[model samples]
Target: MIVIIDNYDSFTFNIVQTLAAAPPGAPADWQQPDIRVFRNNKITVQEIADMAPDRLLISPGPCTPKEAGISVEAIQYFSGKIPILGVCLGHQSIGEAFGGKVIRAGRVMHGKTSPMHHDNRGVFFGLDNPFAGMRYHSLVVEEATLPDCFEATAHTDQAGWL
Candidate 1:
């Protein structure tokens, strides 16, 4: 099972919907995975582990990582044990949990679409280098403050990575 920890974000359901099906270019044999969603504060890391999830996904939220319930803790517990995926606030939580500093973005983007440059690896393997993606964030993970273990894969013209 794939577990999603929602951080009280409005887009949490939207993300779940997107994950429900294989995208257009995906392999034809791809099957819909069993996904379970829970509020960040409503569940504990130990309980999540009991589910034996194949993936741990943290949803974006409207506050800092310290304010998001269990988001950082989940990252701490599942780092080496399972693959963890974090979105906007979720991404910041990963950085915060790993000793990186999270702060206000130089340019806050809300409900806007922006171009992103990626290494064409991981989720971007078959996509173009500069792809347009939705932007909705006021905070960012400081690249300079990131630990040695965390390397950025995607970047935008405005901020280093989001």
Candidate 2:
């Protein structure tokens, strides 16, 4: 089962819908897996363990990780236990949990698109480089101070530097 911890983002269900849709190259037998969604502050770590989810997803939301409830705790508890995918605030929480710095971007990028560049590593692997990516954020994981254990998988020319 796949479990998602929602952080009060409006797009959480949209993500779920996207996941439910068949992938472009998916085989004929491909089907959406069982999924469960919970509020960030509603679920406990023990409850998650009992579910035995194959993957955990942290949803985007307003404010900082400190205010995102149990997201960081969930990430820390399930670091190696299972694969975890963090989006927006969740991603920032990952950085914070791993000793990286999360801070306000030089410019807020609401309803904007940027030419995201990547070396095709990590999440960008198996995809085209320098793709147009939609962005809506005012905070980011500072690349300069990112922990050695992690690397900036992607960036853009129109960055937070304004």
Highest lDDT among the candidates is held by which one? Answer: 1
- Model 2 residue 112 distance off true place after TM-score fit, in angstroms: 0.5
Q: Provide the overall lDDT of each model, using Cα atoms, as 2-decimal numbers.
A: 0.83, 0.79
TM-score of 2: 0.84
Worst 10 residues of 1 by lDDT: 22-31
Query: Candidate 2 at 9: error in angstroms?
Result: 1.2
TM-score of each: 0.90, 0.84
Put down candidate 1 lDDT per residue, 1-162, tens digits, no spaces. Answer: 779999999899898887776555754433586889999889888999889997888999988898999999989999988778799999999989898888887887898988999987545656776989889888887778777777678888877765
Task: List, residue by residue over 27-136, the lDDT tens digit for candidate 2.
Answer: 44325768799998898988998999988888899879999888899899999888787888888888888877898888898999888788764345545677888888
Segments in model 1 whose C-alpha atoms lie over 4 Å from true places: 24-30, 125-128
